[model samples]
Target: MESQKGKWWKKAVVYQVYPASFKDSNGDGTGDIPGITSKLDYLHSLGIDVLWICPMYESPQIDLGYDISNFEDIHRPYGTLQDMQDLIDGCHERSMRIIIDLVINHTSELHQWFQESKASKDNDKRDWYIWRQAKYDDQGIRKPPNNWRSIFGGSAWTWDEATEEYYLHLFTPKQPDLNWENEAARRAIYASSMEFWLKRGVDGFRIDAVNMYSKPPSHPDAPITNPSMEFQWAETLYCNGPRMHEFLSEMNEVMSSYGEIMTVGELPHTPDRSEVLSYVSAAKKQMNMVFQFDVVCIGYGKDPKFDVVPHDWRLSELKKAVENTQGLIMGTDAWTTSFLENHDQGRSISRFASDKPENRVQAGKMLALMNATLSGTLFVYQGQEIGMVNMPQSWGIEEYKDIESKNFYEEVVKTSKGDSKALEKAKRGLQYLARDHARVPMCWDSSPQGGFSTSTDTWMRVHDLYDQINVADQEKDQSSVLSFWKTALKLRKEWASLLIYGDFELFDLEDEHCFVYAKRSDCNVALVVLNFTKKERDWKAPKEFNGKSFTLLTSTYSGDGKPGELRPYEGRLYVQV
Candidate 1:
């Protein structure tokens, strides 16, 4: 008997599609809702149960679609509201759920609320966004009210001469932070924006920058690490403030009325597991789950992600992070979102696999197997199915389109005055943290524009290795990475009772290069093992199972059934017979 555990979303798998990079239907060199509609069958075939489409709301394109200008309408480039409805209908037709990105943490400066708020200090909407008076030093140099750094770069505050006050923009200056402190603003987001989509049949929302919605009562300066550098910290004050729970509870009250919805928040630099549990526990009445970056960000060096050091991570450390994160809410009502690559990060195969051609496929399959067997809703980003790698080293900074990536490079140059060493370091940072690595257009086939678009110029260049890694080639090969993902998802669904609800236990097998674990329940026991390095390793059956025979359910290396030795980059799921 499998442990009695059930949740609609817990049994479903989600696939994230970066709208601008997914598919281009009209030769505009940009992806739109219609483009997505054209690919519904393709998505359905992948066994994906939920489609998490990134923001398509009307925007100024300042920070890609994250800067929403109109919460109720589709961006012109993405198509009309009718197209969105049609996409929703199409998804529903194929028994797939649609969840849009809810980017309420901030809105484009072009949004009506910000426009009126900036029109005059006395305007009724002035408090809709965080506004503070400028502080003048003894020398009469006007500075921001507090020292807070923008995540993109530079000061978090931007001077607005029209109002003679500065406004907070934690991201790009064009994306102003909303004042969640105001109850009315919260109601507007909840009633007018969120309700519009929920009523339109969107199954749920993936709340963007959910923690940044709350702000501290006092505006305080972050401790300055280096006077020359821009304000280094603002997230500490704004994320998960004292009133955050109150606001979330209020929103949850409203969301409960919507009926059977799944919500996940984007949480970065989270404090600890307890805080996360508070937001996701069934009793919390907040979101259903949250996306945390503790495991993925582990490779950052001295400069927290901007460092120029070559990437390095040990398998033991990765395993420890996973175990810790799993320990936080495992077997509890709270849940976590499991993902390896998303729009903001580099491709996983490139970041984790050996450079040799043979290892890429095995490594990709290994990652899929490990993530799929984990006790959470799995999220697969586009192109990950084909084992996509990072853009070639030849890509210059000029070719990148990600606002954050470009801003980081510019900040380094401005601080270092175009010094050759500084420029090289900046390049290294871009190569590692650039969002464009995952935003590159999907490679459907080995045609011009990789069959992503008919236009000669795409928004971003396609990956150079598309010829070998395109979906067309992979779909034809039963042993390809794409096929492995299909198998993985199907197997996860088939073993939902064991894989989804079974208690996870780490194996005592001793090998630095191997990650070993098991999921156990009354009726079944499944072993998940992976070789994280480029050298072969031994997978010694545990002492209790030494004399028993295990059947191979799936293997990246097509290992011999006895499994005394595992191949490089090998991964396997086995069931005791």
Candidate 2:
């Protein structure tokens, strides 16, 4: 029997599947729920305990599935409610939990609520979303109520002539921010929409853009910085507002009544550590964990061009980030959702490792080792296990579907006098950091269409190297990256007490290119050593560590022994005697 005190997320490894590119069962040229259901066996084989499906909600697909049109229904292209229910049932049958994306902060303008709200000023649902009359100066020229800029490059407010008021949108103009200040709206969203999924037996949710749920009552405009573009408000004033904890506590109270549900919040601009800790604290009635972005900003520096290269981040910095979290928040019931790559970021293989096949394998193994050994719930994006890298420049900007990339090209490149240079710079910027890097289809086999779709033309182009870096090809080779990932995942499962729940200790290995750490429980200890560079590095074991006998749990390197030499990009995990 599972422990009653045990939370499912405590030991879970979640696999994030972006549905549109996962697999296509009906040859529709687009992936659907049935396609995902057909691949449950593959996910199970991957040793994943939880599956986090990105938004498949009803939408216009403007920002892909993020711009939700309906809270309770599946997108028509994906499938019906029955299909969603079937997928949930199937996952439960396989002993895997399912977590759907909850995007309550904003809804598509096409949503019934928005439509009704915009129809008339006296509509019952008018206050359900943020709406305000345009501000006019003495000159009588109307402007947005506030000077807030949308995340997608425009004013945050959009005017509706019928209602004669402007509504707020933090992101794309089509997605209007909900007014959580209204009690009726909050209660209805929580009870009617979210509860609908809990009733359907979904394990929980990975709330999207969770911090933007509320805004300050002051409605103060932001200070201007750039003359050419509208100023971005200091997000802290509105985001993670005064009543955030209260609202979350209510949400948590409702969710906690259910059995062992997990809630992970995506906080865009997190305040101080203490403020963040309060939301995740076990004492607080909010969420199980929160995804932190400190690690994601490692490559981003003051100088744009200087930050573009894949170089080694100081292990000391990594150690400090981990230590800071553990010291301030780890033991206090607030946990973290640890990851290297998600749909929003570039692939770890491309971001952190060399692009060469040999180096890619080692880098993949090392990165996995680092993440799995951290004191948080682990998350692996699709194709990460096979060390999938970013797309090459073979496809032009027209082939890309990411809205952010398109906006950058059009707004920054097209408008610039140095059009050719600007376009090249924009392409380079996208080549490394665009969100589309992870949206590429999962490479299942070496066949045409990367075995994702049976149709001649897919919704998106498959990475050309799929033939050399697919699951079918890697499964047969023991030395393959996929096999290495399987071994590492199995080891993590087997040694959960030490690997998953243990305290982390960063070893002072004193090697610039090497990352070494240890996980310790009361009775056992495990050491993880990784060489992030292409040069061989020799590391000395600590003087107190006298045990020469150690079992190699997993390694990117070929051989093992005393004074072991780690090849370029190699990693190893050892169970100490």
Candidate 3:
């Protein structure tokens, strides 16, 4: 066992794999654990130290795998327990760690626990999930238990006629929020589900919607935000509620007994810096890292109500967010998980780059450079290295699998009396701007189905650019985006003292199109510069440092000159002499 002494996550790079779309070994048209096991060599070659596999627990496929039916068992579609063990062994053999998704915040209604809970009022498991009597007003009109609305665009309270009560579901009705206020419920969940993996030697857990574990004691109706909507649920009071830290600390203590395990919380709506720090601080005794959503807000403008359209994020704003989080963690015991794209986000290529093919590759490389150099643990979503773009515009509504996309399309396009063409155009914009764009299948080869499966059909449509953009092709090309990523990961690991745990300082340059930052460790100094716009731009090093010797580590442009000029979307990294 590794000693629990210092921050192990500081130099780690976690790769998130959406197993359902990773690969198919039995040609079942669905990615299974066996498929993931077969590809362990590929992930190992990519320099991945940790693999964060999304939920493969038993589910009915609602909300994909988020609606977990059995926390302790693997979903049949994914494979059996032996398959999971084989994957763990495979990863461990390569010195890689595995972090499974823990979705204890909710469970599928089909789960035995939930089934028993909703059976009767006096049932032993009746209080396992949130349930309350409907409210009655002076006029004798019945109302939902709370004004909270579901994240999937409906009332959070679903009427359960069998129990004569309303149950709470933050997301789809099939997934009812577990009653964390009940100690027995919490213990049962952690002991049964969490311990099952820990005892099996799984490295850690990436808790899903972790902050939503606790809710307000009094089920008050949420205030109205949209009058036209039938019900409105304000999430402020419920999300990140009080007692969250206490619950997390207890959970952490249980995990601590196992070994030097990693814990990452997926916290949403972390209000400001202080709240963010508290969740990740060493004193919190909760988690090693927390993935905050602040960086995802980059695409949105200053006005909160402004419509979301695909646009370029200013280099300064990106620098500020990175600096803010880095400053909070630096000199402290806490750490962060930095990423440009994940399963819940659109591919960074489509979100941050121009639609042109050439420009997308350049932008992808630059973004990879910027993200990999940040002072924190890095995460690379599947296909990010190959610069996968959004699904093509030709896809129709029927072809979409994401529930959120379908709901939004119906609300924004169909309700607005838009035609099919208008809806398709709106969907393209949404895909380019929304989170679903990143959930497409991993592009491994140019073969049919992108080499993900040999089946006649896939769970989700593979990106159309799979032919030109894939791991197999890029692995052979010296200048491919995939190669650049491999190099960047090697650089990070090789220069851990300077790149991983070094001090970060943002450089102030007159050009808004360029991003400049310096990493310093003792006497060693490295500067990273990125050109965000088209056309070349020349940047001058500090006047006093003009004579300093420099070594070019990597550059997107081929030729070199003093204070080099960057080509469109080009980026460079230099080590000071």
Candidate 4:
């Protein structure tokens, strides 16, 4: 039995706002912190229980907001610290909790700590970041400490002339990895980065790349997997280091010091189920829940994170991923995040189901039902509620502003030596699974700018289909995707005892076209069936559920619901009668 823990977050659904793309308050074209405040009523109507704003901290915006220059200060374009406070207060006024993004795994190279660390060999903060001396070959050629490729591509180390040593950067050279091994440095980071907001009335945090905190002490070269390239990918080489749990536990203790708090750690290249459970287990108190990547990563190829090559995903693969997660804490003291889209992933409608004009609405609602009925906290990305799809293929690579996608594209081009076939395949793969899909500007109206900004220029391009998919149009249609999402969320809350805390059991585990599951509580059993493809699928209750008749609670398709048949991309939630 999944523990019936009564945390407010467990009964809540989160709305993630990528501030720069959500909505623009001023005419500056870039979405600001105040922009988020201006739309509180809209979000409140969607029945979202929590608001999770991505990083908008003081930064140069190199990797958007992931590279923070100042932990506590707000970015100039984003707005003043007062704007953040207003957003926080606005959420509370509307009976919703707000959480800000926390990017502690790394910081901008221009950060004061990094500046000082590179100033001199004797600088007090020299050890605050991971730095290694150059290794000289027989011919006196300098080389990086290891052959570990940067997550985005190339060597992970960047040479620093001032320090005469190479600094480790898992991502872009500008974002240096913080050395968590420095106990004093870790304590100082916790106090400066998190305490400032917790002091103000901010509810909690959505920790970015939380699992990448620890680094291997030895920094050895990984086995060469990509022979075509000089460097290789080694996520196993860096994740879950010797001191990861200790660091998280200490961070958890500090979060607890503040009143009630919710923290979610993102494990990009997650380890095994038990390792993931250890991070969120109630006994450890590391986090409220963790976001697992398996469900989103089924199509990921050999070199998981860096490789965008797509694979044909089957219904069984989806079932396995969902069951693996549901089984992780079935009778234990752990919880996991339930979501289908986020800033780092593409839209769900484009991935799991057809995004064609004719089927988009049904596909969107079907995905929403899957997200809401899952046995953990629900997290709905900004445009996900309205069924936003991927960017058009007509858009060139230059239009993709996501650093990871652009980097991967460029790397493939260089590695494949500009082979036409390889480039075509790479582009197709990226179009299907790039991060930019989730970061695109929100579609709010039929206006040319999608009502996101007053200016013609946006930091990221707005979706072209905004004319037909904007919230302004959807809000008025009773059968729109937005309306269905509202109903789904409301029902999730109304059936919390069965949907949130209930035990999950997979039905017809080998089904190829549909996803079926049962959520059972002491007094109720709710069945959720989702058709993942365009063809209709049929399902019948197994022996255990034979005596029970199910009544349609809600459905993605309109009209009377049939007990055993599911239309193309149809979804129906039923309660045992």
Identify the leading candidate in terms of lDDT. Answer: 4
TM-scores vs. true structure, each candidate: 0.96, 0.94, 0.94, 0.97
Candidate 2, residue 451: how far the Cα is off, in Å: 0.3
Comparing candidate 2 with candidate 4, which one achieves the higher TM-score?
4
Q: Candidate 2 lDDT, tens digit per residue, 257-326?
A: 8877889998766847887888787766688888877776556533232225454466566556665554
What are the Cα lDDT values of the candidates? Answer: 0.83, 0.80, 0.80, 0.87
Native-vs-model 2 lDDT? 0.80
Instruction: Report lDDT (Cα) of residue 290, candidate 1.
Output: 89
lDDT of 3 by residue, 405-450 (tens): 6766776665568887656656655656555677777878999988
Off by over 4 Å in 1: 1-4, 225-230, 302-304, 508-511, 559-562
Q: Provide the global lDDT of candidate 3 against the true structure.
A: 0.80
Error of 3 at 131 (Å): 0.8
Better of 2 and 4 by lDDT: 4
After superposition, the stretches of candidate 3 with alpha carbons farther than 4 Å from their true spots are 1-6, 137-139, 227-230, 300-307, 417-425, 509-511, 542-544
Candidate 4 residue-wise lDDT, 198-244, digit = tens: 99888899988888888888898989887877788878878777788
Clashing pairs in 3: 147-221, 149-233
